[model samples]
Target: MSNNRRPTIKTVAARAGVGRTTVSRVVNGSDLVSADARARVLAAIKELNYVPNSVARGLVTNRTNAVALVIPESESRLGSEPFFAALIRGVSGALAESRTQLQLMLVRDQAERDQLTESVATRRVDGVLLVSVHAEDRLPGMLEEMGLPTVLAGRRDAGEQLSYVNSDNAGGATEAVRHLLGSGRKRIATITGP
Candidate 1:
């Protein structure tokens, strides 16, 4: 019997005839739980339509089920850049479908860069999505060395070892140029990210 009201740990616990702590442990994926108890908790959770509060669960298990979007650039660039905005929208849209939180990190200086590195090294985020890859950026290497699951928006011409997703800027540009040139344009100009 579910309504507009959301189910909580207490609801699942009561439905399972167990303590809230037991339900919490099960929801947090604690291996210490007994198999029989785990089954009951899972059944109860399903019956009650209970979705564990990730933030609350994060407090106990230290996994936020969240990802950090680390942009190593200026705020002005993010504000003015349509590419960044569109990429972020796509990222957030996809994440929202899965109920994941996005932590935005802007690294503008050496100190901020160091802080970002330390925070990631300390496991503050489950994963990281790095954007604005410069030719000589060190963050990607540092993140990879730390064993973090990282995705890059774009890579330098030398390419990156980490998984990444990006628009085919080069291919797109070439196609656009070909289109324009085919249409009888004598000159074409393209703007590329730095």
Candidate 2:
């Protein structure tokens, strides 16, 4: 093979004195190949510095091996909120263990939303993790309609049908108020966001 050409499966197979199918099986971690064939393929791969093309593998398997974390907030909000940073760190750490890629998407306007829609339509990600859900937001519905696997950080309402993870905000607030009242704070006020 020429030095200019990258090593292909066929080249590895030739070097290993095995068929292309045997090399493919070994590369893909299929146990169908005999031990001797597997060893030869491994040796050939190391010798040629062969690396499988992930794009080609994904096309053949119909899996992108990637997930999108979609946050519909602006960059300022994402940066300012400690919640967003912690969420990103947790998600990235989890995905790293599985060797999956994470795509962070910010959709603050119609243009960015349109881009997200295009990405989803193209099946660019295996799944989606959506954050900052609101009752009027149509993104969750759209993702459901497309049959994409989705999980939200919060629900739109009590009647939400999508999978979500949410904190007990009402319960926590009630507890806080109870604690304040018990401490004789008669003129306590609370601050909240819209």
Per-residue lDDT of 121-181 in model 1, one digit per residue for the tens?
7777899999997878888889999998999987776546889876786798889889999
Q: What is the C-alpha RMSD of each candidate to the true structure, in Å?
A: 5.0, 4.2
Candidate 2 residue spans exceeding 4 A from truth: 1-5, 168-194
Model 1 poorest 10 in a row by lDDT: 153-162
TM-scores, one per candidate: 0.70, 0.80
* lDDT measured at residue 126 in model 1 versus the true structure, 0 to 100: 90
Error of 1 at 187 (Å): 9.2
Could you give me the TM-score of model 2 versus the true structure? Answer: 0.80
lDDT at position 22, candidate 2: 91
**What are the Cα lDDT values of the candidates?**
0.86, 0.91
lDDT agreement of model 1 with the native: 0.86
